[model samples]
Target: MNAAPADQIRLLDVQALDVRLSQLAHKRKSLPEHAEIDSLTKDLLQLRDLLVAAQTQESDTAREQTKAEQDVDQVRQRAVRDQQRLDSGAVSSPKDLENLQREIVSLAKRQGDLEDIVLDVMERRESLQERVGELTERVTSVQAKADIATARRDSATQELDDEAAAATKEREAVSAVIPADLLKLYEKLRVQQGGVGAARLFQRRCEGCQLELNITEVNAVRAAPRDTVMRCENCRRILVRTPESGL
Candidate 1:
């Protein structure tokens, strides 16, 4: 490509800006905060499930306790009625009195059993309540951590985005100063050379490949036309000569 020496120098600025933009994108994607946010989100989900399960268990225990109390109350009332009938001489026959006494005894035993069951249910409810409290606290902790991680991730992404935008603008400005044909050639070579088609030649070395040029090649590049584009013999990247280059 027949680009002026000044235009090639400007194209180097464009290439540098492009490299910076790529680095910013890579930094944004590989930020540590992103991984942290992902982990925190997963933990939050698990904690939420645990909280739900704990609440369900607590509710079930409460319902069971209520039923047990009602049962105890009903049995106690029936026992009281049976005792009153026995004392009032409502059953005159001796066999009938004996049957009434036996009935009262059975009712007392059933009432005691029901009260014990109520007590057990109350204990279970207390345990479940404690578990629910613990699960709720865990959920809160995880949610807080998730919030912090999200904020950090957002900040990192924003910084990278701003940097990339600036680099893009800078690259465009530099690219505009170069000839269209030269830009096209650079783009085509960039694709074929894995995104690095232009590099500085310093001290008889190709900066893109870090390989030294032979004496004949160096001499030829030194004698070549200044406006003509040169390629590295080893890597085929455009060789922009600098004062430090032996060429």
Candidate 2:
């Protein structure tokens, strides 16, 4: 099959579209918002752990306070029994009476000690409650931030998908106009050159790598048939000469 002259120009357009698509994909992958979203997700997890720890501490303090209150109640009940015994004169012997008096004193001292402990525990429980409250608030704030970050990430991803879809459609349209052999050559070069196969040669400069072609290479490319595929000597990118290329 005879090669159409327009095939070369159409191949250039196809390469241009491929380059644009590559740039768009790279931009999508390297978005700062994606990194921010990842970081925020990690922070949210840490915040959740902190909230769980605070809640566990609050529960432990609450349980301890309950036990302290129970201890105080037990001591109070024992004291009441001692007071009843003293009032009834249940211990008639002098030794027994003296012993009962000592028992009462000891019970009072124990009650005092238990009350002190209960007070201390109550103070600690209050502090834990405050800490839990603060942690809950912090978790709330972190969760809100995570939500916002996730939303932004989703929005960015959706935009990228839309752009990629559009680029694909455009590429398909351009590919239809290119000859099969030229398309095959472009694909082969794209793989060999790390995804960039073609470039426009403008004023002796290779647009792919932005490198200037040497005088000999430029002359050789200029002398080549217009329908022949030419590559930049420096970058090996397929060079498409335009009217302004001074070829």
Candidate 3:
């Protein structure tokens, strides 16, 4: 395929734009925030699990405390009724009075034990509450960091996307000027090779392959017509000649 010397130079501009787009894509993918967000997400998950467990324990302890307090109240009420009966002389028999007094003492001890249990349960609940609070704060802190990272990632991605969009537009405009056959050939070669479809021959070297052209290749290129489309023998990419091409 053949294109004018100027058209081949414009192809290089298209190639530059294509390379820029590729670099932007890579930058977007390799953004540091991506890894940061991933790490923060894992921490958040672990923290949330811990918070849930603590909260559950706290709730259970609260119910246990409530039950213990109820038992204490019930025992105290029974002791009050027994004391009233003994004071009213409702149990005339001396044995009955003694039994009533003994029952009152037992009820007091039971109430005291239940109260102790209630206190213990309250202490456990309080500790669990504190744990839940601490875990909640940790989760909040981690979530905030995650949010910031996501925002940074999104902002960086948007900037790169905008730049890539501009480069793509410019590439379309630049590539549009080339002959259809020549552009088609470049596109095919671009796919077959890496991202570089065309490279400049500079100072006797094919920049694509970074190798100096042999004497025979140099002579052949020197004799080629200015309007001829050239391909590098080493890399098989379109060899665009400029004044610096050292013949």
Candidate 4:
């Protein structure tokens, strides 16, 4: 493959733009906000799970408290009816009256026990309610942080994308004037050589492979025609010659 000396130099410009674009892509992927958002997302998931559990417990405790209160009310009602019967002399027999009084006392005791259970259930529900509230607040706070991180990541990505778009436009314009055969060769070598298709031979060294050309290689390059495109022996990349190539 052959290209004019000037065209080879412009290839270096294309290479520079490609390198810049690669760096920008790496920067976008490595943005700090990516890791931060990941961590925050984990926290949000755990907090949501805890909140759900607390809410469920609170609901269950509410039902338990209601059931206990109902038991207490039923026992108190029974005790009231027994006392009225005793006061009206409806039992008549002394033994029946004594038994009625004893039944009233037992009902009162049962009601008291049920009330205590209701109190215990109410306390647990209150604690669960407080826990749910705290977890919700934490979730909101973490979500806000994640939102900010996402915004930052998006803004950074947009800036890099804009810069890459500009570079791409410039590359298109620069690559347009080069001979199709030469550009095609460069593109092939670029794919084969890890993005560096062409390199300058500066001070007897191939910039692509960072290796100094030997005396034989230097002599051959010196004798080659100016319009000839050369490949580096070390790395098989297009070796572009410039005035500084210390032939």
Candidate 5:
């Protein structure tokens, strides 16, 4: 197949844009902002889970404190009634009075023990509530950071996409001037050659393979017409010769 000399040059332009497009795509995937967003997202999920556990602990502890407080109130009310009975002088017998006083003392001790238990429950509830609050704040902070990272990542991706789009338009413009057969062959070769189907023959070297041509290969290429679309024997890449080809 043969294409005009100028058309072969346009193929090089298309190749350059294709290489840039590949680089842009790679950049989009490998952005550090993307990694940061992923890490923040995971951390946010774990923090939210911890917050749920903490809230449950706080709620359970509060319920325990409520029950303990009710027990304290009930014991105190019993002690009050016993004291009132003792002061009313309703038990005139010494033995009965002495027994009544002893009962009051026992009730007081029991009330003190119940109050202590209530205090302990209250303390535990307070501590758990505090932990829940802390975790909630951490979750909020992580969510904010994740939002910022997402915005930055999205902005970066858009910029790369726009640039790649422009390069693609430029590639299409160059493709329009080249022969359909030549373009098809280049596309087919690109699929098999890691996206590089054509390369310049510069400084006596096939730029695709970066290898110097043998004498026989060099002579054959030199004798070919300027419009002939040629392939490098070393790399099988289409070779577009320029003034520096060292023919």
Candidate 6:
């Protein structure tokens, strides 16, 4: 579509601003904090899950320890009662006295075995408790980092969005002067040309495609009317010619 030469240059200005706005938007999406926040969030979830499991195991181990201690206490109490009877001379017959002494020995052995089981349970519970504590601390640290990362990401996105909004306002002002038909075509081509709708033909090269024009293309563009719109033959982008175009 044809537009004034000056309008073509204006179109390039609009395109330039639009491109900058696009870059800023892409930068917002691709911010390092965005990725960091996402990664840390996932880690936080996994850590919490692990912590829950650890807490459950620790609780179970604690219960086991409690039961083991109770068993030891019961055995010790029975042994104490047997010793008291022996000391009190409660059994008068010789056979009965011999049986009481043997029973005391058996009770002592039972007490020792129960105490050993309690010690084993205590050791395991202590280890599980330690692991739970470590996981809890780690979860707190990871969550803090995730929160910080989220804040940073939000701030960066806001900055970029503000810049893009300002640039868009300026772009609208520049676009208002250009013809509607031309803007429509440029918008359509912007999508088609990978975000570049208009480009300057600088020093015999199409800057959009970074390709030099052939002699025939150069002559045709140079000979065209100033009010006529031109396109880069290589990349199908709106070509804005200036004195430096080396036509």
- Best candidate (score: TM-score): 3
Residue 85, model 2, lDDT: 86
**Least well predicted 10-residue stretch by lDDT in candidate 2:** 1-10
lDDT of each: 0.86, 0.81, 0.92, 0.93, 0.90, 0.90
**Per-residue accuracy of model 5 over 221-246 as CA lDDT, tens digit each:** 99999999999998898999899899
Where does candidate 1 have its weakest 10-residue lDDT segment? 238-247
Model 5 global lDDT (CA atoms, 0 to 1): 0.90
Which pairs of residues collide in candidate 1? Answer: none
> What tens-digit string does per-residue lDDT give for candidate 4 at 26-47?
9999999999999999999999
Candidate number of the best lDDT: 4
Residue 206 local lDDT, model 6: 96
Clashes of each: 0, 0, 0, 0, 0, 0
Q: What is the lDDT of residue 174 in candidate 5?
A: 87
- Per-residue lDDT tens digits for candidate 2, residues 142-223, read 7788788778877887888898889789889878877787788789989998887877888888888898888888789778
Per-prediction CA RMSD (Å): 1.6, 2.4, 1.2, 1.5, 2.0, 2.4
Higher-scoring candidate on lDDT, 2 or 6 = 6
Estimate, for each residue in 1-247, the C-alpha lDDT of model 3 and write its tens digit: 6689999999899888988999999999999999999999999999999999999999998889888988998999999999999888779998988889999999988988888898889889999999999999999999999999999999999999999999989988888889998889889988888988999999999888899999999999999999999999999999999999998
| Model 3 lDDT, full chain set | 0.92
On TM-score, who's better, 1 or 3? 3
Please say which candidate is ahead in TM-score: 4 or 6: 4
Q: Quote the positional error of residue 29 for candidate 1 in Å.
A: 0.8
TM-score of 4: 0.94
Please give, for residues 77-151, the per-residue lDDT of candidate 1 as tens digits.
988998898889788999998988898889889989999999999999899899889988988888888888888
Of 4 and 5, the candidate ahead on lDDT is 4
The positional error of residue 12 in candidate 1, measured at the CA in angstroms, is 1.2
Question: 231 in model 6: Cα distance from truth in Å?
Answer: 1.7
